[model samples]
Target: MTPPAVVEIDHRDPALQAAFCDYVPRVFRTVDFRRWCEWGEWNDDYRAFAVLDEGRVVANASVMRMRLRIEGREVIGYQLGAVGCVPSHRGRGLSRGVMSAALESCGEAPVLLFANKNVLGFYPRFGFKPWEQALFGAAFHAVPGGEPAPVLDLVEAHVREGLVSLSEEGLAVTERFGSRGHARIASWYAANAFSRPLRQLHADAWVFAGVENGTLYIDDIFAREPFDPRPHIPRLIDQPITAVHFGFTPERWWPWAGVAGEDSEAYLFVRNLGPPSGPHRFPVMART
Candidate 1:
């Protein structure tokens, strides 16, 4: 009998892409499969590996190429995401084969992934160790009455330049603390990370935030100068915002909040294909 072939599929191939998209819903019930399919439109740099059984995709893994600033130096790396196997194929080792193939293709680049608690014991076989890093950010009470930040068209050169400055500063802070950071922000990432039509509260500030459950979640913020959340928090959304939470640890602590220690989640893991480094922080925008 011929064994199922495991190979990397070109995302541009519509037929294979559709098959891969179709397989996702079968393995993971919680995700919006339609939105997951739309992810391919903004992300062109990813490669999908699949295990085909009888001409159908039965297992899949996605590897996304990313440019990261590790210890103040820019390095190319890969992020592993959307790893799954069909229920009937679970015990057959198809996922292991597909993951092994994907890692082999990356050569010497570092790979990062967020695994669920259920699979905590699985990634260790691939040399992925638990990454324990602190989550720092402040909680702010909505002050109300300030003008909202202007929505910058990220496609424009000047707007992009402004965002780039913020990214550099953010990297500098991470580098100071002996952590790695992502150097460049792709337009596709911004469009997906932030809301569609990409809105910002300040003209000069590049803050990627969303309002949920009456709490504003600040995912990422970058500005040429120090950003004060005071003015823009209130006007971020028309509905009354009770508080704001940040994903990154701000350089300057806001008076309205205090830093507290919290245990890191066990699902976050990393495999260093090169030299070993100290504790590192992954940007919230990069999380799958």
Candidate 2:
């Protein structure tokens, strides 16, 4: 068998980067390639690894530098995404080679990823173990005399600035959870998740959300201080939302009235390179 050449492309190289983006859709057709490229937190530091067979890109993996709060301290973390292998190259070990390269680059930093159901057994070979995640859902209610919350376009500059403020505040509160690691929100996350920021009654507070299937998903709630989201829920959504779902749990809040459900589509797996700890929990917003 002929060996495939493996190379890492810097996102700054326009020609190589465009080819990488174009290749991803062959495996993941559910998302709009152009928009998916714009989604998530990406920067010049991000590395895209590809396996070239006779100079054509076939297998790919993405390694991203991320910040996470670990054991009450801010630390650099890594996330792996965009893992795919062209259909014709399925049994070539190209996907494994690309992932090995991505994990090697992570070194000792903690690594996390969401894997498709079919590939759930693939990551275990690399020391990654499946972790159960809890999803909380509750019936939506209206607050008397509440005004509708305006949805701001995340692509706009001013709106992104506001999201930054909320994210910073949210991170600060996340520290109090100690021992849990949460991915810090980047400016591009809003675009990736198609999130909108809603105005809160409290000055400088905002709720980030996205809608699907008549349900409003609360990605994250940010405020100068921790506060109850129930009171502001009515004003934060304009549609006749059937229920409100918590994506990530903020400090001091638990889904007491909500039912817990398991995520059957995607499974979270982690390979801890740092200290040995118990199962870690991250909010839905942190899912990359």
Candidate 3:
């Protein structure tokens, strides 16, 4: 069989989000996608699409971003994800279908994504030219007495008590990066990424859940700051600490000298998802 034809879904739309909640599991359910949508986890800047065959989803793609209304003009920055084609349908046209749909929908809004160098090669065929590195590893330091405590209670308490301090800090960083043209990180959240933190399901929680392992110090904490990770050492090294680890963006956030400094780099991928102020600098996927 040629397989089912491709269909791009407007998953962001409320009706669609509700309609597809149950069916998403039959195809893709790595994260609690249905619950995320049910909890108001979406932005207009976010777009979700899929490829269907025989009326069932065989492929999917999602691009989540934030909208910046600068001087009355909307700037779109997107992070691509929720991408995969059913195994049985692999090597067919499903990947092409969903991928093409996602990129084309990006329009002239300047799409960006963090993917392995090998994967980056596949994007250009759709006009997703690489301008920088978006993927990176992260490091963490636990509080001594604090003992790199699990985010479970912390996340729960915050939600229970409206502990928006972290979110606020994260937002500040998001705003800073958004202003600097790194809008993809700050500007949006994909459903899978959104509800985790919203539910206080942090990297540490995931780690503790055996989803990963160890202290669950942290996993992927997307931020908008685009700042050096070194300065946070004092914060990372503060008293009540237990352990620290690094992954993703090693060069930038890792403790190379076991010391902290204000000057360091993090791994990231940047693209002009919107109008550019002028020339920009980004890493080539070849190096990532």
Candidate 4:
């Protein structure tokens, strides 16, 4: 058997980067790292560590330098994503090599990752403990027979550029617990994963949302200015919604009706950060 070589991929090297992107879909079928990088959102903060067997990437972990706002305090942290090992390389401890490299590069900073269901048991070996995240919701009265908001195409050059600018200038969605400098990661989901329409309410405000089970789920709201999104909710409703659920923290934006429950869908695991005492939700849009 060939020895595994763990290396930090230089994304500027086209061939090595392409090999890394190729490895992503083989492990995580749904994500498109290639398109995300190609769309020009991949910034200098993101770095990929990979285990290469005979120069072919077989296991990988990618890290991003994060500026987090935890309980109104600015924290310099790290986020791990695009973590996976090809099926053929499983059980070979290849993931550990990449993870070690990735973590070492992060130094002593706090780190976090949202694990896939199958890998819930994997992160604990690296001193990561599962963390609970709160969900915020409120009763929403939508206008009956309301017109749908115009959808913004995220792939559009102007839209993408605008969001990148807003990400730097916008106020944190929640100082209680949110993120900073996260537009790059958010663009990946906007382009590939989001099935809902993204509606621009203002020159600087955009909302990504959809209706589900009479609930209007607002996945994310990007804005450069501080504005109340509540007033614009009526324009976003395509039908009558009984309630509104926010994916990102609304402490700075809305009067949330308290914690609805734990966000079970987010399999969050962290290292170095203590469990949040009060209700907290990591900004959904900021996650990688």
Candidate closest to the true structure, highest lDDT: 4
Ranking by TM-score: 4, 2, 1, 3
lDDT per residue (tens digit) for residues 1-288 in model 2? 655567898755666776787787788875323553454334554788899765567998887676666557776777787898989989988998899888988997788888988888899999988776556677765433466666666566566656656665554434421222222333345545545554455656666665666677776665666677676666766556677776653334443535447655548787884432433335555565
Model 4: per-residue Cα lDDT over 111-158, one tens digit each: 999999888999999999998898999987876444556788878878
Decide which is better by lDDT, 1 or 2: 2
Q: Model 4 off-target regions past 4 Å?
A: 1-3, 144-148
Measured against the true structure, the TM-scores of the candidates, in listed sequence, are: 0.74, 0.79, 0.51, 0.93
Superior by TM-score: candidate 1 or candidate 2 = 2
Name the top TM-score candidate: 4
The digit string of per-residue lDDT tens for model 1 on 1-288 reads 344478777656777877776787687765433443453332455788899876678988778776655655767778887798988888788888889888987888888787877788888999988767555545555644667656666546566556556655553323312223332333445543443333565554566666777777665655445656667677666566776665554444243443444436636777884333643345555565
Better of 1 and 4 by TM-score: 4
Please state the error at residue 13 of candidate 2 in Å: 1.0
Stretches > 4 Å off in candidate 2: 1-3, 36-41, 53-56, 138-140, 168-203, 210-216, 239-243, 253-259, 273-281
Each prediction's Cα lDDT score? 0.62, 0.64, 0.42, 0.82
Ordered from best to worst lDDT, the candidate numbers read 4, 2, 1, 3
